[model samples]
Target: MKHVLLATTGESPQVVTETLFALHQEHQPWPDALYLITTSRGQSKAREGLLERGHLARLCDELGVKQPLFDNSHILVVPDANGVPVDDARSLEDHEALANFIMTQVRNLTADPQQSVHASLAGGRKTMTFYLGYAMSLLGRQQDRLSHVLVSKGYESLADFWYPSQQQGQLHDRQGAPLLTAEGKPLIASAATVTLAPIPFVRHRQSLPAILPQTGESVHFRDVVRLINLGEQPEALRLQIDLAQQLITVSDEESDQRFEFKPSLIGLAFYAMMARATCAEESDLTRPSKKRADTALLKVFLDELMPLCGLQSCADWQTGLKQLLDWSELKGQVKDNTIDALNGGIPDYWFDQRKSELRKLFEQKLPLTVSRWLSPEIIWAEDGALLEQPGSTKGGGYGIPLARKNIEIINC
Candidate 1:
């Protein structure tokens, strides 16, 4: 009789799917019982407690992998005083306990004196993988067994595997054909050097060496990276400005007019409302500055605007703005009269208050301005003279104006 044990942490669905495929391939020749060992962290979740463990469990069940409902008979999931599971115990101790539990369970399965055990380490975090492998080592199979599956070039999608640095900046086809040279190959390939990082496999006592390699002489177009984060680099600001200048040079204003003046009106409205609300609370405009207003705008946009616009799923601003606005509240405000309560004209105060409130909302809700490769420098002044604006710079804060389009400063 053969017992095949597959250990995993179940952190990602991709891991589970890949492991299942590999298990089915390996177990094709013989009749085998399956054992799934998952750490506490491997449990899959759906939307933060709405339905936590069901998603991954169902996935496993669909693949015909079987396991008991609980980890073992001795331990149960009991709630604390706050009704939360305090599962943070000794990691190594938990591994030993689990190993003992598995050994006990397998003992009751068959009466055959010559039983062979096969263990596969395919998924889970590094620590979990190491612990499971350690347990399996102690169990010690008496047959042909191996800890890791050796992958070549095509198996890039494997859980923790990575290509060597010597292969970096090189594009390979599915059949492992070189697509481009790593160094500068203008049209089809640009010869360039790319650094690859080493992957640590503590369980198997194996590590890959770092390599930086040059590719061949062709740019297969498929080798290009579509998305990259420039992060907080000043070079990002220059890149965007360069791109904009290039666009302006190649395309006439008449041809690209459609893309030019579509200022973020909803973004503007959000900032306006925040600034207005905070300014009304205190007679001083300094009380609700642009930075503060931007922060507030971000909060409302994330918590309220995205949900109301039915764009919560995507969290994209373009989709949010395209949704229809009822404008019912604006109409109601227009009809109401609260002029005598304020010495300043109510209409004027209302407009100013609304603008400031929107500004405050954006200041609060929007992410802090940072340099990105696509960020434009048309708005920011170089000498720091334009840094100071309308509001108070009292508390280690820089002033930003609510009405200006170029308030973003990418100093990085």
Candidate 2:
């Protein structure tokens, strides 16, 4: 199997040699090839310090190690959207291109079953290192590795420094001042310390759906990481709606655990309706209904609320429920109609205000974390109106995105 060293670098190309020396001391397998990701300025410095100055070749010769296959072609400069080599990643576009480039390289390397990649993030800007590390986590295989090289203080960022030489040699700082050890002795290149710290990561490519490169869409780093984390959790959540108790029970089937939320009558009605819609695979939950409530849908909402509101056994409950269910009657209340008058006459507007109130009540009743997790799955709105139809809609809405198999609706 071929071993590959994939690294990112900025102005400091010595990181490569330092990393190689540390790996050698640890008796790790040496790479047969070296690939570097950098910027235009970084490319120039690397070529000058490693190739032109013969530091790389000298290190291999002195260490009695075979030189890896690294040359001008092995250096990849991050490019802008216009295909121009980026001088530095200072702009948003440059950063995006850098991410894409790192992801592409990681994907390409992982595609080959015969190769194992060793990624080093010790060299390069913080953003560059972050992108490289994240990309590797996304696509790395079991055999792949990630690491950061640590050089002893005195030798860090020294221009003439490459690795600990076989013979003792004086080290100088960037400004040509002699670097000294803590004992006040001249720093010797041969005695410089280097350590390779391996980074632990969760490789999620196998767990996630295969994302083809040809799609021309780059995956957001955060999204990839979030999905990986979610996969590591116990299991997907299952929801149970109890209309009688005006409660929503969220359970993790794998852990046999549950969380309950008690919402107000209006909130419970809205939530139960959404839960039922999700269970039935209804997608039209975001569509604006005609100004008047659909009688059947109105009944579904009322049925959920009546039990919770203690109106089920009242002699005038039906009359009160009808007035409460009327969107015009509800809307008229916001226009200064007394609560008593709202129970008798209808008006002209929709019942969006009620939906908003329900949303706030439902969210406020749950723990912030649970509310965030459940919000997208159970909320829907269109043209300021709550949607409760049995079909899917393309417009914005809130409701659980779960299938009927995951939801259970009980009368009590």
Candidate 3:
């Protein structure tokens, strides 16, 4: 199997050798090939420090290790929208391009079944390190790894420092001044300390859908990481719908936190109906459908909502049901003459509008952070939706994607 070391670098190219040294000390498998993602300036610095000065070859020779396949060709310079190599990732456009370039490289490398990648985020700008780590999390295989090399404070950022040599070697400062030990002797590379800390991440490459590049469409690296993190979150949360109090409570067993939401009666009813549908094994109920609302279904929903609405009498429930059923008639669009069509029927447009209103109400009542995690469980998209697939159907509807065991209906 081919082992590959993937790293991101900025002006300082010593991270490559530092990481290599740490891995060797830890008795980890050394990479057979090295690939560096950087900007134009970074590429030049790497060439000067590692290749032009023979630091890379010297480190390998001093350590008595086989040199990996790395050269100018292995250095990937991030390009801008115009295909011109970017000098630095200081602008948002540069960062986006850099992210895309990193993702593409990770995807291509992980495509080979026999390849194992070791990603080092010890170099480059902060954004570069972030993007590389995120890309690895997205596409990394079980055999793949992520790490950041840590060098002792004094040895870090030193111009002449590469790897800790076995024999005594001269170490110089940025201005070429000899760095001395406490005894006044010239410091050697062996005095430097290096450690490689492996990073743990949840890989969702297989779970993510194929993201084909579209002309006007783009995927943000952060958005992808957020989604993968959400998917990997343990299903330890449950929602308790207290219809009598017109409140929804989200309980997270893992965090031992509880969030409460007080929505309008209509919003609460709508949410309850969706929750009921999801629990009853009705798939795709969380999605909005163009199909008109069935009168029978509407009647069942109203019946279920009456007790929650605090209707004291049958007459009150009947009046509320009549008001909803008469919406189409009031709009002067009476298509069907049957009692079911007149009393319980609802237009698809009207249903969708009501759902949108309910969603807005719920969102307004819930905390922003909590709402993000709960929106998919509450709001149903009309089109182009990407959410958890607990179940599916040809016709869309509104429902949560949670297991029935996690939902509880209290106080009727």
Highest lDDT against the true fold, candidate = 3
Write one digit per residue (lDDT tens) for candidate 2, span 143-199: 999999998877888887899996648978778888888999988898888999999
lDDT by residue for model 1 over 264-368, one digit each (tens)?
333332333333333232222222333233323233333333332333423443333233222223333211132121212123333345445433432231112
After superposing candidate 3 on the true structure, give the runs of residues whose Cα lies further than 4 Å from its correct spot. 182-185, 210-412
- Tens-digit lDDT string for candidate 3 (49-158): 88998888887887789999999999999888655898876677767777877777887777777889999999988888888887887778899999999988677787
How much is the lDDT of residue 46 in candidate 2? 90
Question: TM-scores of the models, in the given order?
Answer: 0.26, 0.55, 0.55
Misplaced by over 4 Å in model 1 are 23-31, 45-114, 149-412
Could you tell which candidate, 1 or 2, scores higher by lDDT? 2
Q: Which ten contiguous residues of candidate 1 have the minimum total lDDT?
A: 204-213
Judged by whole-model lDDT over C-alpha atoms, candidate 3 comes out at 0.70
In candidate 2, position 269 carries an lDDT of: 68
Please list the Cα RMSD from the true structure of every candidate, rounded to 1 decimal place. 24.6, 17.3, 14.0
Using lDDT as the yardstick, the better of models 1 and 3 is: 3
Candidates 1 and 3: which is better by TM-score?
3
Q: State residue 233's C-alpha deviation in candidate 1, in Å.
A: 58
